[model samples]
Target: MESPATTKDTASRTQRPEGRPGYGQLLRTDGAWSFLLPGFLARQPYAMLTISIVLLVEHTTGSFGLAGAVSATAGIAMALLAPQSGKLADRFGQGAVLVPQVFLHALTIAALITVASTDAPLWSLFVAAVPAGATAPQISPMVRARWAARLQGSPLMTTAAAFESVTDEFTFVVGPVLATALCTGVHPAAGLIAEAAVSLVGGLIFAAQRRTQPASARAGDAPESARSDQARPQSALAVPGARVLVVAVLGIGMVFGGMQVSLTAFTESIGRPGINGLMYGAFAAGNMLAAVAVGAIRWKRGPQTRLLAGYPALVVAAALVAGTAQLDPWVLVLGALGTLTGLCIAPCMITSFTLIETLVPAGARTEAFTWLTGAIALGQATGSTVAGQLADRSGAGAGFLAPFAGTALALVVVLIFRKALHTPHSGLVAARGVGHRTTVTVD
Candidate 1:
């Protein structure tokens, strides 16, 4: 049924003479902009959630401790619930999962705002936060799933990985800054109000892109056996590779968490707390730049090979950062080291995502992505806690050890499970057999 000319065009798109597709080429795909634009907006609130919750709750209750506890509750809820949301999206469809969730999330935000504003019991803020966090759409993972669905076999999948990494970095860098500005400059509740608004509008638009969404295991369409299979419970963690990635990403999360707390401590110790953002910005800029560069290159090595190589590089980078923090502890020195550490982050992140695509079954791809997201979140939380304790007890730069420890743990896992990651080819076969359309990949 395939025409020669059409097939030729597909080949041209997938296997370019340059070997790697550029962002311009990747964006040229039909309907990409539709989901991408709204998805960008939809994902921003995730970054805003912590800062906004902290500011509004603190303003109302006049207690940073209470605000932190309430924010942690939301963070914990989101981390636990996101994978389940992804699983539902896998079964029922993204649109079906997202439509009600966006509205419910918006309503919960409203309720949370009301409770925070009123002289209500502190328990009500916690209660309002759970549903708000639980219902927030996991748009980043959903968009990545869309890219996988659209461009699985193509080299542009590589580009997509890079672009998503950059997008994620951009959102984290911008979102908190925006949220902080709104909370301080405008009103305490203004940041949260904006979060609710964008989440509602952007999530709805993202959900409306039905044509671009990945195929779900809907009941009527699939064979009875397949339907029965879907009925049975499945977790993405059932895949060993998924578990490995969770651990690896958890380490990456620790790196972020460690850096956040350690950097803050370092800045405050020097009495130049204002430059904290600039230091972190240097790190993020390196990550974004590296992601851009990595995506532009063509590689003969598979993701597994690249990942094995990248993780060690990350470990080394983290160690240097740790050493610099403990020894010299100068602003410029740490800034350069932070940038070096960030340069190492994107490749590993891009490869981890690429490997997950290779290794995960399509039926649970979104859930698998969410698991990694959740892992990073958990890692960050743990890293922050440990780093904060260290900063308090051992002085300023000692908190840097947390990131090194995290990277070392990840490296050990990757080296130990190197054999398990080679199952990508078999994973693809398994996914295809399960009624999901998947393309063969060289990796």
Candidate 2:
């Protein structure tokens, strides 16, 4: 019973406006591109270098057990110290904290290489790992916070996150191969040295950017506020949505960690050790492709819905991977597809972070985000330890199922608690007028 004119008006209002830039448009922005370049340069090679060093150490020692233990120790150290580092960044600016840390990190890496290449006792190797891990700069979180601060409420923030996720995928996809080639092609020691040098250069370059430097200290503020003002933002964790998101991401991290070892086992069991890298590369490729695709689309639904959907999909993907392991003939093909199904990863992460930004107050932003990072590290460490043990015992097939089961359990818990944990928009909206509130949006 609607008039033709009225119907047309409604349709016009609901339809997406023409000439509106999509994800590509956002990426094309000066600020977006400006941020992207340095971030990519700093992170890409860093990932490759780190992974290569780990693999080299394991190969040289001829002990997976030692490698796993060392990696886990590092992971735990990072998790424990991340919050403190993040808090420092929020108070004194990331650049201030980053510069010194990067130098220390570089030195630690060099020392590790020297000690590792020698016939140092296992205790010496373990002792060196503690300092190396402690000195590791929290670069990823700082970069993320910088982008959030610079870009604010624009869709560009999401785009930036998508870009970061793509970088992560690329790093994982290419890093292992690059690392292996470097170690074998050159020397294992050379790889560690290269990684340390690159990290130092990258960190210094990022710090040198005048625009990206930390804010100058304000005059006449209370001791507490003054301290908090200099630090990275911490307001987000106080919000219910951001809190739940952090928890969920931790679950995802655990699943990823467990899968890492399981994938290695599965590849070896199938008598195709070389294909192990290929399978992992394929998985990362799938995630990259999906992230690009998601960015290309215009979604009417909220990020929360997207995240909820992605979690279950991961569960299904894990199951598919497990099922394929039983069908030896089709394992490779199914493995690829199963990996593709996990394409939702980047988009989900992007959405969750964007939502966190929207919900958290400016004062607490950095700390909240760092907490998410720490949770991920913790989950990964836990997952890796448990999964490695399982694989060592019952066979690789059972290892593959670990992630599936863990993801399923986590998803169920989140869904059951969703209503209680759902963050209201009122607090975020109310804070907009305050100095600490940067942006507020409701969907």
Candidate 3:
């Protein structure tokens, strides 16, 4: 629901004063807060839905193997289809792309539950999830693209990216908990049902904010000025830093995927598998805090520099985990290390995203972001596979080596392409955003 204050702000249609606004001011802009909040409502359940499905299937069929397979199918679908959905949004528009897809996703949610309830067939669930995921709106990209388009040529662009990272981390933190609660507390299907409803409503509202949508590319490639900044002619993939960034994100994904496995393995090895959530929560908490702080403060350095710096921090942290694996009883120490590592993780992700925005052409923004995410998913799959294999061979604690190895590889990639990351636009973006205060009102 829109807060009364947000409604009032939108109704008034005020603009930010002469200077750049802080995170608080940017959100206070007319329709901005209301527009931004719904993406969370819509996207959080996506994180939750996989676990919900797994739990539901496992509980009903008493087969974790089948449940894992079903859930993996949904994830694979998302990874494969996200870029296509994003391209449609760029070619058509966000509303045209998101509204119908989100609706279909909701229906698929219902159909999957009903079909599964009848014990129709395990393959039925897989079939339903293909459409569910294919139709799933790329809400996360839409949110980032909206902010990028709306704040183009402004300093808050970087801050907006940072804030988006914080939102993602926070949502992951909350999403699983909510799903577990709904599935366990009510019924297995309750969580999926709730997710469907929210995605429907929230996506509708989010897509309605047409002013923030990236401007449509012109027909027959009209002259540049005829289109908005978002409709530039340059190929998005051809953008200077974009390909390297994709490679970097893949490595980052591997690091994250390995960490999840090792953390779970660590807990299980110590005979307290349930404590994994608490430790992961601590990790997310650090990411959230660091992202917020990074967004609020004015950065003297550009994101290219920050991206170069971030990978090494993650490498160190991952190594620390492997080194400390023998201290099985010291969960607190491990958690603290996780949190410290996350501080580096969030900043690296936020900066890379910001740097990419600076490099992507206006017409290809959505696809560019989606492709990066998909690459990360691919990398994560690699990390997960390797970690699981290592665990089977050498026990869970040794699984920590996966993240450390992945991050070390990533650090090398970032260092190799560090210079190309600097762009003419890089310095201007953050400078325009910081050391100034202004009341914001969205266009």
Candidate 4:
């Protein structure tokens, strides 16, 4: 007969082999690809179509003021509701939250088309905008959380993130062109219809996946390890470093929003309204290039270091934009400068996202990601509002310079708080030891 101590040791050795798969193994499995494909397809076209219609409405109405207001309203509503939506995902599973939200969003888009076609009052348009904004599904966060659950700690997480960034770039590039084509070539309503169809189909497909479904609501039926994994840091807002990441991304969004208005206004002021597309395209192209480059370059540097390093590039880009106020150069030259200046965007966003992924607990991932999205929306709204007012008061030249100044200010603030924001205890290190260790330390 075996001694009790020997038997206990033997059981421990036997059980160790049954441990959960690491991030690498998860990515290599079929499930990761299945989850990723649906998310990418669903998001890319929706983003493209939505932006196109928003711009088309502004162009058609001949009121940047109304456009700005509508955009701001939608943005503010989305920002406010996004966190709650994330919580809903946590409570009711991503599929349940996402599928219904996508359907509602589709209906909202259809309604907006009707409202735009009629001679509706501005207030009516604003009122319709509320539902449109509020129902904007928390697609990115939900998809990310699903990916985290499936892939855990593998390179798939990085790859999936890079894929998302690339898709965003593709959307910016393709969405505007498609929107413009629809608005100018076909009817503006066609663009709205197309967006609705994409949302409905994509949303439904994503929601149908078995892996994406919520866990069964039975006592003790929950995946014990997964539940405990994310339970600790669900309230990420209280974390100092996470707060800084949100603030930094918000400022970045504001800069981009202002830049959009300023760039258009400047193009029009310089007798090149037709070239607005070219300038914007160039900027997006730069960002795309940077994203691809960064994705290819494997870096061991912490997210903060990457973020801090990228800031000066943005500062230079902003300075260049400010200088464009007086440049009597060819349109192509100006476009090139704008494109080169935009190189920092992808790197900055990627770093911020990676930091959030590393810092926030698994269960709180959706909420934390939603906060980042909300920050971007809020920033864009602020920037657009400020730029529009400045453009009306001064020339578009002055408006174009505004984002540069804002970006410079943001850079300074981020640099000042770099040490606090980049501290080791505040980042991905916190998430690494959850199951393996007894005590998890969060800063």
Candidate 5:
């Protein structure tokens, strides 16, 4: 017979923590919010960077084509570097990877600003963007991977994901507005300088916090690590089905990237150059609302199946954006149109992420998610590159057609190649069951 004390101890050990923790649990269990702050600050600069560069370059060269080419080059560099950066983080740790990259990224921004101020060779302006993008920290992917890791298969993860999407859309929307204001009210170089400062401060703080970083594969800096490339498990990319999903993500990126240049030109064409960020914000607001709505209820369908709806929804959103081009600037019709499209933004992105999570093995969390970021950047680069030329020639309105075409192509891709999205029983259950209570709402 066990002693009373021993029996009591056994019960305490076996009993699990009580109650389901929804949104707030993540913060309470760990100081996640504390670290997320630095990550947010660091990421805000990314939104500022391209717009600031475009403004500076366009002002200096008096050519939107040159500006667009620079943005595209930087974006391409980011797309290629993102996955490699994630791989390093997974092998080493976040601190080692982030700290150095942040410093380098800051330096690159400072150099670009100097060139713009001094009226240095225009070629140098383009050169500066290369390092600016290559050194951009892998913060977003790291944060998402952390959430997925912490949440595991808990139903609350959907809420967490929705929250991430809402916050991200909000930041991207706000970042540009702030950038525009600084450039318009202050000096054009002010935005880039601000971005550098934010990146440095926020990144250092995040790196110092070692408690929350994802576990690395190796113990330390050793030639022979615990897992070698040859011995490692196959990556998420190895799954043939993942090809369609990644390509779809790439298409989405292109649309957003193209829209950025076109929207900037559109504001210029309308003689309200300051309104670019607000327009994007209006669209983002709709996205936030949708994310909130989705988080409130459980879905009856699998996440993969749910993704099919997003492609068409995006198509409608793009068409509406193009439609508003014909409306008078005084109509203020964009807010309603922007919000309408926002309704679909969260659903589309979150579903894609959830599907990726379901398909990828947990070990490759950071790398897999980072690839998503790369795809987005690549698409955006393509958009900005093409749209810049179109805007220079045909006008901003014609450039709006880029996003419409991109999204339309996205829809077609999913329709024809969507068979790969079929999830197994476990993935299906994860979406509908595990904490989801089936409640229907016309989504």
Candidate 6:
């Protein structure tokens, strides 16, 4: 099913020079820029959602606990539903799933903003959040799948994974800062309003880049062998070690969720609310820097070892951040600690994604990616909810504990499942062949 032109393109790029491909060379892939451009915009709304929700609902109800709870509801909904979205994208194509989903997402976000602004019942906020989160575009995972399609057999796959993580970090840098500035400077509702607009416009543009989208699985494309051997395509969760990775990512999400809410509360308590964005941007900048460094390295070891080595460092960083929040609530100390925390994050995330490429079948690549992302959302929701309550009762310092606890639990999970991370190379090759050439969409 590979086109002659596409085949030739891949063939030309497979031979590596002296070192690994640079980020510049990775972007030179034939159709990379088309999807990457729109994908950057499409992913921003996701980064904005947590901070935007926290600020808006807090303004509406005048309670951080309620704000965190409402944001958690949205995060939990997205986490539960994202895998299904990935499945639909896999089956029906990204455009088919993304176009309608974006419209619904925009509508839901508008309804949420209106409800919050009008001081609707607390229940109404939760109701609006479900569909809003559920319909949020799975652009990050979808874009990663496209990279796999283009660079599956090439060494650039590793670079692509690292670059995507860096891109994700960069959006976090921009999105929260932008949301905070809008909410504090312009209007409380401005951040959510901006999130809705970007999701609508950006999602449509990304969905329109059909040529770069990965192929969807079709009934006809199911090989006779696959049909006779199985009743349905295997779930990505069935892949060995995928669940462990999800648990690990959920822990990281907790750090994010806890940090955002706690940082906001901390700034407010200190009577300098506007500085929250700058501090969060500092955290994200560290993550972006680490991601770049991780990608640039040519590792002889596998992703599993990197994950094992990097995660404990994250736990230590999270603990240090918490200690700093409790002992010295100054902006400068917290900001420095936050950057250290961010530096620990990208390596684990980049390695987890790399493992997905090694472990999951081509048919379930997007779904597997979503599982990790959704875990993050779910974890973030949990962290926010817990930290919000803690901050309300004790102080911002108490909220900082959420991330430390989350990271500790995640380290335990990773250490326990350490052995399962390995898979036979032959099995991976066999699994990847299931539907390699099935095109999901076309220009």
* Worst 10 contiguous positions by lDDT, candidate 1: 428-437
In what order do the candidates fall by lDDT, top score first?
6, 1, 5, 3, 4, 2
Model 2 C-alpha lDDT per residue in residues 308-410, reported as the tens digit of each score? 7777887787777766665663556856764665574665555556566656666766666677777766666666556666666666666666666666777
lDDT of 1 by residue, 1-443 (tens): 44566456555544443433666777876678989999999999987876577668767875544565576567778889987888788789999999999899889999999999998888989899888778878899899889876764565665676678789988867776677668766888988899999999999999989888888876356445546766665677888888898899889888876776677567767887557667867777787788766665555566777788999999999999888887856789899999998899888887787678667776566567778889887776567556666766787788788889998988899899887787646433111111122334543
Best by lDDT: 6
Clashing pairs in 4: 23-154
* Predicted candidate 6 versus true structure: per-residue lDDT over 1-443, tens digit per residue: 65677556675654443344656778778788899999999999999998899999988887888899999999999889888888788778899999999899889998999999895778999999888888888788899889877775565775676677778889999999999999999999999899989998999999999887777766356345444534556688997689889989999999899989999989988989999999989988998898777765545456677789999999999999888888856789899999999999988887787777678776566567778888889999999998899889988788899999999998998899887777545332110111111112111
TM-score each candidate. Answer: 0.77, 0.77, 0.77, 0.80, 0.86, 0.88
Better of 4 and 5 by lDDT: 5
Residue range 2-53, candidate 5, lDDT tens digits:
4566445433322323345355554553556766787787778767777777
The lDDT of each candidate is: 0.76, 0.61, 0.69, 0.65, 0.70, 0.83
Q: Which parts of model 3 have CA positions greater than 4 angstroms off?
A: 1-14, 50-73, 107-129, 145-159, 180-194, 205-233, 261-274, 360-366, 392-394, 424-443
Higher-ranked by lDDT: 3 or 4: 3
Candidate 4 lowest-lDDT run of ten: 430-439
In candidate 1, position 289 carries an lDDT of: 80
lDDT of 3 by residue, 1-443 (tens): 54566445433443554344566766755556756878888888766666566556656765444554566566667779887787677678888888888889999888878866777877897888667656666788888777755554454555466567778889867765566567656887887888788889989988888866776552335235445554445566787688878878777776655655566567657877556656766776787787676666656666676677777887898789777875564999898988887777777776777767677766666667777888766566556556655665677677677778887887787788776676645132442333232222211
Best by TM-score: 6
RMSD of each: 5.8, 8.4, 6.7, 6.5, 5.1, 6.1
lDDT, residue 244, model 4: 78
- Candidate 4 lDDT tens digits, 109-223: 7777677768877677778777887887666666767755544444345545556667677766655555545654577566567666776787788888866454633324555
Range of the 10 consecutive residues with the lowest summed lDDT in candidate 6: 430-439
Regions more than 4 Å wrong, model 6: 1-6, 12-20, 151-155, 218-232, 360-364, 424-443
